[model samples]
Each structure stands twice: as C-alpha cells, then as structure tokens.
Target chain A: MLHRGRIQAQGEDLEESESWAADTPPTWQEGIAMIDKLENKIPKKEADLRREAFEKARSFVTQAGENGGVNAVVQKTIMVKDSKEARVDIEVRKGKAFI
Target chain B: MVQHLFKDFLKNKRIYAENVGYWQSIVSELFAPTQIKAEAYLQTTFANGEPFLDGNPIFHFVVKKLNKAVRIVQEVAESDKLEITAWISNTELDEMEINELVIVLQLSEESKTIALDLIRTWILNDETVKNTKLKIKEINLTEEILAH
Candidate 1:
C-alpha cells in the first residue's frame, strides 16, 4: 500500500513541526537493541544502576509486547539535518546477514 | 522547538488520526485481508533526544501472505527536505546483506515503485516543501532479531 501527506506549518505551526522532527520515536530496531543491551548487562559494582537500567528496559519490552511484538510496533518518523539522497537495495539469503 | 508546541503536537488527535488514516488507506491496497490497526503512545526520550520505549505504534501493517515486506518510514530532515528511509526485508530467520542487485528479483518491484511514488506525492503536495525533488535516501534490511 502507498500513503501520502504534506506537513506544511507556518509561523506558529513551524514550532510544532520542528518539535515533531526532534523527538520522533525510535523504530523497533532501536527498541530491540535497547532491550538486548539491558537484559544482557553484567551485574557488577553498579548493581543499583544496573537494576534501574533493567527496569527501564523491561518497561520498554513490556510495552512493545503489549502493543504487539517488536514487528508490529515498529515504525518511526524522525527529522535529521542532512542533504544526501541515495536508494539502498539489500539482498538476504535464508539464514544469514545482509548479502 | 518550543516545549509547549511539541507537547501540543504530541497530544493532537487530529494529526494522529490523519497519519493513521493515510497509512491505512495505502496498506489496505497493498495487502490482503486488509486488517490494519494503529495506536499511538508517548515514548520517552533521552537527554540527547533519542527515543526510548514507553509508547505504542501509530500504525501497524502486517504482511501475512508475502515473505517479503517493504516498510516506509517518514522523516523530515531539517525543515525543507523530507528524507524517505525504507526497510525491505523477508520474514526469514537469516541476516541479509546489501549490494547493487538486491530484492528486486524476489520481491514485487511494482510495489516498491508504488511506495516511492507515494513518498514523492507526499513531498510534492506539501505546502512547506513543495516543488522539492523527492529522493529515496536509504534502504536497508531490518536489524537482526537479537537474543534477549
């Protein structure tokens, strides 16, 4: 399916637009990486900090699962500062990294 | 830029509905069964402004029949340019690599073309970035599912 929309904000609207661009949510890819990091962290001198991190990561994973696994809740709209345009094409074999 | 404006946009139900409606319309034509659901939530961000978990997805498109799927993500790079980043992946248990010739042979090229056109229209029709050229900024495979 194809989707389309134009975000045209003026004086006041521009403020809101910029905000949207700044804090756009992270994609599921990023979320999973975070969960993995939190779950596999070593318990050492920073036990308290580690626990806090665990709670934060657990909340994220729980949230993603509740919404529908990472696959379902994976979409993001962000704004960056760059001016390069190029189309990327990837090939995947059945059981390997990008090839 | 301002905190209140950002807060207002996040809470704006109208714009949220518009986003959901637009994606639903396009995804309906692309997949069978036409069962698409979208929900939005407020995610937390780090001091560096990176998004973290704590919210729901605004729109979810499920591909049941095809092993390959093309996911479109919208990003407004700066204020004038709209950068289109997409992920093309197959529902397999393997990691993929990138080269010159990719999924064009397996996945439906027709669908890819339609997706690009849709993004083009989004930029062309926008009042803010009108007359700007549309280009596909990046296409990559979805990150590998890590063991957690």
Candidate 2:
C-alpha cells in the first residue's frame, strides 16, 4: 500500500504510480478541478484506504490534544516492526519554560 | 523574550510592579480554554500617567485568543489534528492578531529568544503556530500495545 509519503510493502505501487502519472502541476482553478476528477476516479477501496489512514492520523492527534495542555500536538510516526506490530512516536510542542 | 518585552513595555508605560502579576494573570487566563470571555478586569494607572505601553497589551490579547482556541481543541479531541476552519473573527482579525503578536512578543530580547525558540520547535515539530496546518502520524502498533 502506498501511504502518505512512503511506499507500503504491498502491491499498492502499481495503482499509486498510475495516479502519480496522472498528476501534473496545475493552476489554482485547474488544481481544484483536478482534485474533483481525482476524487471521482478513485476506486472505492482505495478511497476507503485513504480515509482510514487519515482517520488513524487524526486519532493520534486527538489523543495528544487531550493529554497535552498548552503544548501543541505535532506529528506522529509509526515504525512497523512486522505485519502485526509497529511503534508510534509522537512529537508535541514543549513551549518555552521560563525559570 | 515575552517577559522582557512585557517588562519593558510596562516600564515604558510606568505601570507598577504590583500590577505585573495582575497583567500576567490576565494573559494566562485569556489563554485558558475555560475563559470564553475575557473582559478587562481592571485598569489602574501608575502615578506617572505615561501613555499605556504602545504594543504589549493588544498583543497579549491576541495571543491569549489563539491560545484559548488551541486549548479548546486540545480539551475536546485529546489526540486529533485540529483544522480550525473558522473562528469568531475574519481574515483581517487573524492577520492583525498574528502580526501584532509577532511584533509585540519579539520586542524584548528575552521575549524574542523565547518566541524564536518556541517558533523553531513549532516548525521543526510540524506544529501550527497562528494559522497553519498540522499533521500527526499514527503510533506504531507495537508502541500502542506496549503502553497497554
């Protein structure tokens, strides 16, 4: 599965490559139109996968937000240990502490 | 730097040290999520009657607002990325809030250093400051399991 910025260890690359090929630098309006077309063209399964990924990202953030006080929630990265496991790293704004 | 800027601004305005805590409390409270409305609690003056410091007051106001919004999201979602589409203000208010905050908070050397460091961390961490985007990647499955 081709994830946000990385190629997942799966046969997802073929479809992802095709989508990437279809993508071109677009003007503002063209960009909007392109997004519309892409949204329409994407397979339901692929769309579901993307939505799941987005939700996962959102969940990590939500958890950080709940726990973090004034600190801002940053990024979370998951390192896959194997097909059934991974490690999640979360970054948050520590803010400047004045002594 | 914020402290210095605030101190200098206060000095210039001839505000008394007795009032410093009050102002700080105001700033901090404004940033609190529970503070839905922040009315001017009190406005007393020093004997000198120097014009209120040129910038810090308003700057504090805006920062407090942003902080409040951030706090609100943090309280509600716990771990969700926040994309604040609209708040109580428009683009003009947003721009002014950010600009004033940068200028006022950057005025004092200490405040500048602190603000810069905070800003650097915010950027490096991919966290939003005033009006930017933020993304949180998922935790690895192993870490989640371990935590449990």
TM-score of chain A of each: 0.29, 0.28
TM-score of chain B of each: 0.35, 0.20
Best candidate per DockQ, number?
1
- List the candidates' TM-scores in order: 0.31, 0.20
Once model 2 is optimally superposed onto the true structure by TM-score, how far is the C-alpha of residue A52 displaced, in angstroms?
A: 10
Residue-level lDDT of model 1, residues B1-148, one tens digit each, is 1111112223455654564465566555543343423222212233234443212233333222322233443321123212223323222212322111011111123333445354333322221122222222223111111101
| Proportion of the native interface contacts kept in model 1 | 0.06
**DockQ, every prediction:** 0.06, 0.02
Q: Estimate the overall C-alpha local distance difference test score of candidate 2.
A: 0.27
Which structure among the candidates has the greatest lDDT? 1
- In model 2, what is the error at residue B73, expressed in angstroms? 18
Model 2 has a clash total of 21
Residues B1-148 of candidate 2 have per-residue lDDT tens digits of 0123334433443443433444446445533644344333111211122322222122222233443221111001112121111112111121232211121122333323333343333322324533331211122222243335
